[model samples]
Target: MGFREGNLGALGHGIRHRTTITTCLLMAVFFVCYTNREFLRFPVEHELSTALDDHPPNTLKLSDVQGVSTVSGDHPANSLTLSDAQCTALFPHAFDEIELALSRGPVKRSLDKITNGHVRARIYNGALYLTDRGLDVWHRQSAILHQIHRAIVTAPSPSELPNINFEFSVNDHPSGDVWSLARSDADKQVHNTWLMPDFGFWSWPEPHIGSLDEVHDRIIKTEGSMTWEEKESKAVWRGTVKWNKGLRGKLLDVAWDRPWSDVQRLNWSSNALAMEDFCRYKYLIYTEGVTYSGRLRYFQMCRSIIITPELKWHQTTSPLIRSAGPDQNIVIVKDDWSDLAETIEYLEANPEHAERVANNTVRTFRDWYLRPAVETCYWRKLFRAWAHVTPPVGQLYPEERGTRWESFILMHRLHWGKNA
Candidate 1:
């Protein structure tokens, strides 16, 4: 109902776009051995639970309806502008019963479309039963959910059927026939954060992005109060060194644990510290790990001026820092992370200017990046476009052959229950 009219291409926030870099994306296609469905459910660490428990006071709250109501999938809807949409004001406690049905593929449907990870699908009973080679948890949890949540929130009614329950992997990256489909399809950037916007943060714990507002608030309370001169002079970088093969190690070398630089090997994999713990510096540097770093979103929420190398990957937060723009929200460096020390000194020398840019960084985050409103708009647009192309759902696992669905049910019974 609140749909706004705008151009899709206008979605670019104007950060300087970079050409795709050669990375793991080019490596050999890895296939995941068939595993039990229980693998999809990851244990929620206590620290992660605590960190997310910190929610902002001002988050949007849906009122009026006592509980979720069923909505009709066949209900007609109009296109909306990206700016006019908002995050689902309310979501039901549970998602609809659906499965992402993937079909085997070797046929190249389109030559031009980025089909590396393309998964084809058709709309059936309000669900996008997808056919792909494989599924990855990182993409599904981070990038893919962005679309599903929008549909859940904006459905004609709560009762409207949900779509596409996934048999995604627990591994950091997934392989197999589904890789190409999961990565990209003819037009579905559905799972790529750079191409398709997401929360730009992790939604791993049940109740997506549960602790983000808290992270933002803590950063403000602890770091925002400090004057530029009062804070640590050097830029800070803290995270695990396991996944970020080249960049993470290269970064630590640059900092060399100098008197001013607070860089350390904090194993965020175990759990993240409180916001105050990370927000003590005037400058912060972000480096990618595995695929994309969710920590970048955490860094942006801080009062510190963010510095990092050119981003090889992107998420919902890409456009703001994408291309070097007039307002210095982020100081992007080379992949080698060259001149980090020099850059730190330049910002420290101009305390007033640095602080001003830091303020702009906050505004950029609050006003646009990952805000419920911006996310909502993009979500609506994705479904709106897909409606025109939805195909009829065909049975992915026929009775004559093996059915992964049975394995899914067994896994649910053996491991994860309704609570998970």
Candidate 2:
């Protein structure tokens, strides 16, 4: 009896050991498969690193005798540094050619004159301005402005221009325009508006659009369409204006003209909202008799839809505030005002669908609209603009370094969050 009991005990122990071993093996296999899958999925070229560096065969050395002038001792100040000269030589005739080409077009119209027009121009520091009135007539309304700018900056002369020709067809009207011409047109517009300097097109240009009021009033209207709808249940209405200007306009045009999936459309909409809330909603519904500031008012005007999530609306001084609740309700009550009554009433009446809608809206803002990715992109763009205005190396300015450090911090924070 004792021997049989011992055998049974040993057999149970063996069974437990086998089970533990099998589990561990399975887990190991899973981990390997998961890791390998990602490794294999990445593009091979992207994963590879070349051993050889293909820098320019020769670098130019700057000396006192090389027509280089120094402001203090051997260092230059305001004068073009070696790096600046190198950059200029890399893209010789870019600025002059752009200016000349843009001049060939009709005089650009002023901000006050055009009802609906777009000035897709770049600005530099505070010089070399370009405006719609400054450019010639034919190139003023050209859609290939960006292309033209790129051509003239990268390859100013016709001989320097790329051999490849870009053609665009609008209702069977195919225009065989040279890339350089398009870039020239774009550069001209950018220069005229003083936007080229800010964007590294020309040198530093002054800020053209000053106050938001001027921006709002002077924005060139496009021949686009807008759709409006009122929510039957809530005191809110939604509107969306489809314009033929800006990046969103270009994207929408491409999507509609080409074969795009519903997922793509949704992605585009979400991305558009991520960039600017103006594209998602046009109006902000508020309680009547409440006076709003210009900035807040402008936000409402640009928004496509407005809804009052709060119960009571009162006038106060504060910007729009996003509320955090289980329903993801957004309360835009004036500062120091309570709209609890109206909000409660709406929630109670639409209990069935209110929570779901609010949750969905909140998710959109949290995941896409206000995510780190979008903010990072904005900061990157801002940094690029700053870099464009910075003086060349050896003639470095204090502000440039400060801006660079600030940008670096912003970028780091964006990537790793505050904890990082």
- Of the candidates shown, which would achieve the greatest lDDT relative to the real structure? 1
> What does candidate 2's lDDT look like per residue over 27-49, in tens digits?
99889876564443334212121
TM-score of each: 0.54, 0.20
Most accurate candidate by TM-score? 1
lDDT of each structure?
Answer: 0.46, 0.29
lDDT of 1 by residue, 1-420 (tens): 223323333333322232222233343222221132123222222322232345221232222112222244310111122111112222111001001211221211332322333333323344333333233343443344334445445554423332322222223233332221113232433332113343333243432334454565556667655776787776776677888868988888877866668777876554355545566678887887766666677677766788887765534345456224456788877877678777777877788878877767775664335444344444443443333233322444443222232343334222354665
Model 1, poorest ten-residue lDDT window?
A: 92-101
Root-mean-square deviation per candidate: 19.4, 27.4
